[model samples]
Target: MTQPSSEKINDNTSFQAFVPAVSRWLAWQCEMISEVKIGTVFLRSNTANNNLKMFASWPENVSDSIEGKLYDLAQDVIDGKNNIMPKMTCDAGQGDMVYDTTTLPLHYNNKVVGAVIFLQSVRSEDQKKAVFQLFQWGCALLESTLTDMYEEQHKFHPLVTDLAKLALQDAPVALIGHQICNLLAQQLGCKRVVLGTMQGLQVHTLALSNQLRFDTRASHISEMEAVMEEALDQDQAILYPKSEEMFSSVTQKHQTLSADNEDASLLTIPFSNAENAIGAILLLRPRNNPFTKEEVKAVQYATQLLGSSFSLKLRDEYSFLNLLVQSFKKKTQPVFGTGHL
Candidate 1:
């Protein structure tokens, strides 16, 4: 395996350009071909920096660990220096752990946008061939999805593009949270935006675009946070207009929030990843500007796109060196406590 490089990775926000075919949180499909734990890494291309940043990874651990050798080989495939397609890139072992890897470059419009890497535990030539064939099919499926996403990027709204920039920026999480809320309030024409995530049973406010410092004791802030908690507790987006559509048990807090804060259209949507709800956003719009179904759908879709982008940016900001220090973690833990990328 190649040693880690000092190359600056591109913080490509292109993920927002493409609406994923299926929510990654829903169908985070990672398949195994035989005993081989194949990993397909989609790197962000078409950015200023050529160095690849992971888009999605299979076997999950591959997303966190720096697969220098695999990435380097994939880079070679993209550079046209290694034209041989679907070849075993590396066969190595460390202690009892063996990693037999192969690289296949994914090209679009005659340009290599990303690469697929298949890694198996067995070092046998016969097994490597099987993994290659299986990975080829996987590549076909992935490439189709990427092509659709690439096409969708060109049609995305200006706000979507701006959201991409916010996601890619090398900024602190709190700053990013502020930017997201500010952008939502500005472009979406909401009265205000409250962004936060749950801490224990209570919601922890991250950013209030209009208010620099969160007033935890404020009655309105506490009520909005309660509405956020209601949505998170139910694991779904809660729109004040659609309160009647929800279970009666779920409707009480939403009803109370709306009653207390009359006129403003309140909506809270959960920000989730592959596992569970990580955070929520409460958008307050003017009384006259009632939300349309189209608007609701757009908001849901935007959050879906954002959840993955935010997760990647967050991990990018996390210390890979810290992970290296943590005994070469195979599976990434929920990385919090930060440093700059």
Candidate 2:
């Protein structure tokens, strides 16, 4: 498959470490195309031999994964010689399927370092042009996400590593919640971080940082519960003090809490395993200690792993979870059993 072809670069990182989101981005590109999309591949050159190889492909095709010079035109584009992008249509898929493929060179420092190959059902040249444009948008997003991931890894802050270790540890959910609250409070300069778990439907305040005693029926606690539950119910991370977001029950509670606490800021991130939210974390900062966007984003990403772990333990805890629950009951008398919720 081929007739149309078309189309940056940055960074010095090896192409071997591809971004995980690129896979999703590929699938998304397949969806947005105005034609029947076949697949897309990012081809990179092997530095050792200067031979072209498939770096990654979407909708997985074994043929694309193979090491081969499919065409001289593609090789020419990769070699910084041919300026015309290659495009063609060919038979693909099992039982005689057909597809249109377009190869566009990706340049870096005026050198052709890689190429993007797009495939779909043979369509009008106009459709090919539209797809070419859409593909560019996908590439831009891919680049941004990869750069973000790279910067995050390069930073490698101690707190970030420690948070990762904490999330990955084998521990009871209650203990994990308590430790996470404490860790966030210390790392982010939060006055308090209340870890709340969605037991059945209602949210239960499982742990609070630094404090051993707090009123369960306190107005502030009620607001926290409301805000946390809202986040979990909606499965979103929210920043209080009303940014460019809508007014929900959680937002309203946050506004009330802010007024009472001298406009203290709040950041609530729901803990979900991609299926459903199991809990949430509410970070409370004093007036002068507002949470930054970077800090909020870092905590939100950290919760992705932590939330999955929590959900896994919540649903599949055989002995450890059961023992933990029993122990909690024996010790603190179960602050609101899921049954009570």
Candidate 3:
């Protein structure tokens, strides 16, 4: 079976796109069993909380009666009920076409999350047992898929949560930026991490991990700013020692920065708000310890949260400064005689 791609599973719509393929495979497997008439798969839709939607149905022309019955059986399985065995056969159509239904719940972390249902013609006891076993195996494959999807979606929750808590602290934006850099460096095992916020079209370095202060005009800092601008300009993540697949991304500044620093592996991810690019994060580590897809994704998520926090803090600072200016004007108006002094 072709497993769902990591990138697809991380997205709900893309994940659904692969369900039909899995259902097709399961339908083919069921066709091997002559007694099995129809196979349907139901999964909990992330878009609709707690609602189980029909992900795929084989033959594409199943009667409404059969589909409704299958949905009921699937719901039963998800509700922790006993497997609804073939207690009796019922007419699925107007004619004497009788069928028995069976459902198996798909589990992830030992909790029922979805189900697979099969409608089969009347068969002997042994035949029924074989069909049930096949359904069980199919459910196992689906369970494994669900587990992978769930893990991929949440693998960065801890990192994001930690960064969010730090960002929420009542501190200056620069101090918060420094704390974020320090946390990211420790979590991601980077030799250094730099945070920069976009000012007009240029990126100004805000904080560097493990350093209380540094000269902004330093050559190394300038190179780092250039690297961030390279990513912000392209509006995409850039990983230096660029992969063969990333030939289109302009990484000239990244290459220079990495070459100047012992050929270190460098990653720059730009974060933006609704308007435009707001900030970027640059991480550096040894060349041998290149960043992985998972690490890049985690940082991307973290940067999004950080960007919003920083924007809000900066806005607040601007508002406070305006209030202070107005207060000073009011205090000086009495002494200055309102523009005559």
Assess every candidate by TM-score. Answer: 0.51, 0.51, 0.55
lDDT of 2: 0.63
- Evaluated with TM-score, which candidate comes out highest? 3
Model 1 poorest 10 in a row by lDDT? 1-10
Candidate lDDT (C-alpha), each = 0.60, 0.63, 0.73
Off by over 4 Å in 1: 1-154, 243-249, 309-341
Query: Candidate 3's C-alpha lDDT?
Result: 0.73
Q: What is the descending TM-score order? A: 3, 2, 1
Query: In model 2, which runs have C-alpha deviations exceeding 4 angstroms?
Result: 1-153, 157-159, 212-220, 245-250, 318-341
Candidate 2 lDDT tens digits, 1-341: 12112211244335566535556656655554435345544445433234555555655664532224334545766666655434443445544545566666654333455666665667565445444544554454455444445445332345544665565456666676778889999988888899887878988887799875678788777778988887776767878865564334357766776777778888888876555677888998997777776787678767765665565555546556688877877666467664653
Q: Report the Cα lDDT for residue 321, model 3.
A: 93
| Model 2 TM-score, all chains together | 0.51
Candidate 1 lDDT, 148-209, residue by residue in tens:
45344333345554664564455677787888888889877988898876565778787887
Clashing pairs in 2: 1-88, 1-89, 1-90, 2-87, 2-88, 2-89, 3-87, 3-88, 4-87
Model 1 backbone overlap count: 0
